[model samples]
Target chain A: MPGAETPIETIISMMVGRTLSNDALVIPDTASQPVALEVRNLNRGREIRDVSFAVRKGEILGFAGLMGAGRTEVARAIFGADRRESGDIFVHGQRVSISTPKDAVAAGIGYLSEDRKHFGLATGLDVRNNVALASLERFTSPIGVLDEAGMQREAVSYIRQLAIKTPSDTQEARLLSGGNQQKVVIAKWLLRDCDILIFDEPTRGIDVGAKSEIYKLLNALAAQGKAIIVISSELPEVLRLSHRIAVMCEGRLTGILPGGASQEEIMGLATLREPAMAVRHAS
Target chain B: MTDTTAPAPAAKTGPRISGAFHRLLAFSGLIALIVAFSLASPNFLQTQNILAILQATSVNGVLAIAATLVIITGGIDLSVGTLMTFCAVVAGVILTYWGLPLPVGILGAILAGAASGLVSGTIIAKLKVPPFIATLGMMLILKGLSLVISGTKPIYFNDTPGFNQIALGSFIGQIFPAVPLPNGVLVLFAVALIAAFVLSKTALGRYTFALGSNEEAVRLSGVNIDRWKIAVYSVTGAICGVAGLLIASRLNSAQPALGQGYELDAIAAVVIGGTSLSGGRGTVLGTLIGALIISVLANGLRILSVAQEWQTVVTGCIIILAVYADILRRRAL
Candidate 1:
């Protein structure tokens, strides 16, 4: 019982120390089983620091933080939108190197950005094209021509399944409401069969009706055994939708709280910050 | 923000309706120009003058189509004019200087142009240089290279017999004697049609629009944006090579000084054709019509004895008006 009796704080500090170097810290194989995604001491220069957490399949993990607290940066690093200085990312218990969004998508992770206008949807394209944007590889022939019929059929099915209230599949994405646009982006990643989706500010600009729809969609996705990480600045929304909550402050994970925690409890964790260890290490 | 009066389904037809409306407006503007020009000069309506206009549009039209592809990817190619000249000089070296076959010259020109575009694309995509600055550098570099290679003088293809036939000869003219449409115009038509088909039907075209619309979105979608960007520029460059072939065959020479202002003209035509300079939306047919409008205006003004300086002034004003029209349309949307 000597090794088994190591304190949790000691294990965490070991992870923090090992993260400063390039070595992947050994993860304890426990009876609980590994989650869909597990990050140990993920470091990205100054932007992200010793950030580590886990979200299992069929669970919604809410990430709550103040602006510039590195919640988005952590998500970007995990999804490979940004480069990490050191860390290990395990997707479904397999250590994976994701250096770009392309790698992340191939690894079955989808990210819905906070800024939908610029980073989430191509506003000028039709709904079908937007939905098919991530999945074009599936609809392409050997000669590099797109299979229009197949794309349309799949898009139409998603539209019906997701209840995207567009008039038809050919409707342009920009014309759709904020919620519909978000739905189209959801449909896009869903059709691509991404097992883990990171929704950053999922209902930011959506109307009340569409916000509820998105919540329902997220619930449905989770029900289907997909892992979801919702990054929301809104405490109430996060508490309502998440099964568990991870809080960050000044680029570090302060604590992971249980679901339905009071706003004050989450805020207390979110404001908890330690002195910048990255600067100390740099000097 | 809480206004729920507008249902989602009703707004669905808005894009298609507005698209058709904009195209119709541009087409009517083209028609208006034609009507105005015909009223100004009787000779403008003549078949000879119309053919001349089409011949004039051939080079610029092809170049405009090339520019359209680049612009659709939210990028630009200012080097297209000099790149076209570079292609022509490469062709001259292969055909006239080396005494090689015509096909070799054609292929050489296209390959050289594509190579130049690849370099420019790498600068833009890999180096993260903005398209305008990168293409501008490429323009100056290519222009200097063309001048240096051609010995700072025209590379004349006069010794190459039947070279002019590539542009001037017309099979359609043989079929219908009265039409007398040049092969240059036919080449422009062929290029436009193929470009249109590619833009609408192929994965490349889809990515082109995707890149222009939201490059970050496309990149995040797991597409290799850099590779597609390079491919788009290469296609644009190869098309510029075709334009080079057209101009060189027509003039029987590659004049080093003739290409500097052509980039502006091609960009102007693209903007006038309703293709947004910011990228994301365009059509080959719009570009063809835009090129025709420029040529027709130039030809008609010449027939009316209007001064060249005034003609330039009018064209500049037209470009401003076209962009203003675009702004108005987008604002309304």
Candidate 2:
């Protein structure tokens, strides 16, 4: 009957029914919806300026910038790793003040620092302790004694789920490979039930094989309905993984584009700084 | 993270072997010291001499335990000695001057120590002062305060009945006459056991290790590091209170000037126990053994009629050798 319908009727029906038939391929549903995290006018007075971006739920927001483009500064500000001069942060459309990393975590935001050895892990602690580090309160008794068995069980589960390669859950974190260490940090945040994860240089020192594994993990986390922000210097990595990419230049966010943007286009936005001649008077 | 291309299997065996070797080195060195001392002085092996050495170890052993916690957090507490004196002076004030009950005096001394430790911790954490300089300043301050509080005179606890019994009296020996161990040694064992349990089992204990291992990482994990740091110092201060109680109980008086060099002895004991002064690696059991080694060395040399001045020199050299040994062990790993 539909095939026998008139040309005008069929054209109208196709136009109206297109979304219902192929909505999954047509667009990402959350792209135009409310954002999970928003940063506005985050200025640290010296290193950062007027950085603004939004990451919707179930999306991977890639931050692509050069070495001195203030990517880390912005991330630190958002995570409250460093004090910001002025900024407004919104989590799930609700404005909140983040003065410390504790406040950030309380607001369901987690930051995995670029320097894994110094800032992302306690190298001397065992794997189970590292996984339970952030969410220790969950396994702690009322009198402050840790539930060692519960922690060990949870850690082992994460190790299995994440496929983190370690000899045993009791192995000291420092003894693990770089990729495994990164996975441990990720497991820590996940155990804390954080919905928004900011990973700074996720694969900085990881091997090629582990890099792919980490990529799979990030996608899996996004599929689990968590918003993720990935900061990377590798353009191909950013382009390949991001749903949308934001570019920064000289402490300011210059532009944002779709994931499929050309490499030349991204590089152009990444270098869009103020003219050198114009800076003479300002200095 | 430095991506070491070294094979995982090789790296694994290296640290394991070195760990066992370091423990063996420390234990054997202690045994060797005891054998050498017994050969030098026949009295060194006698039970009375052993009891005397243990009695001498009580106060210093307690202080060394306090030092162990601070050092494991990659910090030094130079104020521990003077803090002990201050606590003893407070106990004197409560028991003699205020004429309070024995329990009140004990509690008073502990509270005073905790309060002072809190001040020092706040100065270090909030003011961003380095532990060495801050505790050094605090050490001087407490030293001056102790003297001022006690009027530069020893406060005798003659009025307090059974006060000396706190350290000298042995309930264990009363029950089993053959053992004849002082109550102070029991206190040391109790403290070491409790500290070891806490360091290995509790959230507070884990934080202490984590703070030493990587403070920034802890902060990023949403932990209130400053509060935990203050707690560590406070716990140290409370332990110093117990040390104060032991020393005052032994002497039946609080001597403000007697505490000037105790911090050095305590720190030396901690180092000899193989606790890394750089932080993160230490154990209560190791600290207990270290305390014994120091006391035994001192007692043996004294029994051999070595000059006190020469004894001091030997102790200094031994401390250097112990730390050097630790460095060598770490380098081998």
Candidate 3:
């Protein structure tokens, strides 16, 4: 039912179902419509040109592109990891400006950065501390008082839930393997209650077993009606996990189609940028 | 969303219990030294000799603790000696020149040290200069300023004769009056305790370790590494301010030319105490012990009638050995 999206023209007539609020706007039509997220003329500029699409709840929005093809930029811009010059982003039809990562977190958007070792963790801190870092306010009193016991318990729960290979939450994050570190990243986002999750190269550098575990987690998160965007350089991954695929090339959106679209069609759109732009220039 | 998860206990690898025991082995060398020294001389075990050693270590130990924080952050401060002297001179100016109260003079000394340290942090963090070079320049500037401020002469606290009581007055000894330990020893311990608290607790302390571990990693995590680095330098500088107060208090005068080579001694104490100069691994207790080691060596040698020049050579050897031990430990880690 979320998959059958009537275009924005229909949504305009459905304004009677919208509720006004200060920071959060709840649209009655979009709320009950089963679509977790919808982007109407989502313009991220230079890289993403007049790109528009609708992704139903619990469906993965797979962004596929070659290296430096603006796919990573899209993830970054939407997650508020990087500021976009101009764009309209909505979580459940509530328009939001994500100027900073803190803002994104408050808006229930979580971004898993590709560079996990550097951006994702404080290695000196134990695994438990790293997991509790993002949502530290929840575990801490206003005056910088950290409830070590509560934090430790929460960390242990995440570790068990994720099946991470850690001796304990007390073990330093520095000592963990690559796959375990990625698990810690996922646990961090989940603790923050992020409804819209973005994973950039989620399985990069992970071994086969760990990759399977991550895929399983992604699938499970989707089943719970979380809006997911996965940007991967790997074609097979895009094919396997994506509900819909958006192919990009040379910093511009070339095509969008269902996940079942043939690789040949996506490849055709990926190479569409230069020839079409060159032709336009000549004209 | 899945909750069915087991807390997989980490598999044991290396000998856990032995590693901790090995860390406790730093005292073995000191024990051997004590046994050898006691056998060589009767006075080596005397209370007078012990007090003398502690008093001698008081200045260097305080300076060492200051250096330990910087060293732990993978940084070195070459200007500590001159910075200490500059602090003393500033206090001297406040006490004698402007006729300020004793407390103001003490505060002035520390503030002077902090101001210069702030400059060093700014140059290194904002201007992107290496810590070694930036602090080296600061050392020279402060050294020159000490002379200029004091007109190449000693500034005595003779006008406020009671000023000597800060470090010279042994409040602990007076309470007991049996040992009559100098107040300087108490100051050294207090400084060490405070430094330990700062290094082990607080957010600034965390970032200090993080900056030394991987600075860019910290920056990418959205932490303002620059501000923290500056704070580290300021803390180090504030400690130097304390050192200046102690030195000036002990000498009873702010000698313009007195603080030339103290930085080397402070760094030596830090290294000998087991703080890795390469950063990311250090402890305040290690630095305290390191200061004691330097002073004990000096005192033991003095009691054995070792020449002043030989004492310098032995200290140099110990410093090299200490740093080499650090390198080996780092490689092993």
Best by TM-score: 2
TM-score of the second chain of model 1 compared to its true counterpart = 0.96
Judged by DockQ, which candidate is best?
A: 1
Model 2 chain A worst lDDT window (10 residues): A18-27
Which residues of candidate 3, in runs, are more than 4 Å off? Answer: A1-59, A70-111, A134-147, A191-197, A221-227, A276-283, B1-23, B330-333
Q: How displaced is residue B19 in candidate 2, in Å?
A: 3.5
What lDDT does candidate 1 reach at residue B171?
A: 74
Which scores greater on lDDT, model 2 or model 3? Answer: 2
lDDT for each residue of candidate 1 in B1-333, tens digit (9 for 90 to 100) = 112222354563555666656667778888998899889888889888888889999999999999999998989999999999999998988888798988898899989988988898999999999999999999999899988888888888877877787789887999999888999999999999999988998899999999999999998888889999999999999999999999999989888777888999999899888898888998888888788778877887888899998888989998898888878887787
Predicted complexes: DockQ each: 0.29, 0.28, 0.13
lDDT string, candidate 3, A1-283, tens digits:
2245775434433442332111111111222335555555545657655555555677788888888888777777665666676667777778776676667777787777787876777666678867866765676555445567887898999888888888788777777776788889888888988877888899887754456567768877877777788889887677777777888887777788677677788778777768767899789
Give the clash count for each candidate.
Answer: 0, 0, 2
Q: For residues B1-333, could you state the per-residue lDDT of candidate 3 as single tens digits? A: 433232333554332333333334445556667788899999999987888888888888888888888888888899998999999999999999999998898888877877888899989999999999999999999999999999999999999877787778889787898888888888888988877776655556666776776565454343456777888888888889888888888899999898889999999888777766667667777777777777777778888999989988988887787777656654565
Q: Which of 1 and 2 is ahead in DockQ?
A: 1
Which CAPRI quality tier does the interface of model 2 achieve?
Answer: acceptable
What is model 1's DockQ versus the real complex?
A: 0.29
At residue B55, candidate 3 shows an lDDT of 83
Give the worst 10-residue stretch by lDDT in candidate 1 chain B: B1-10
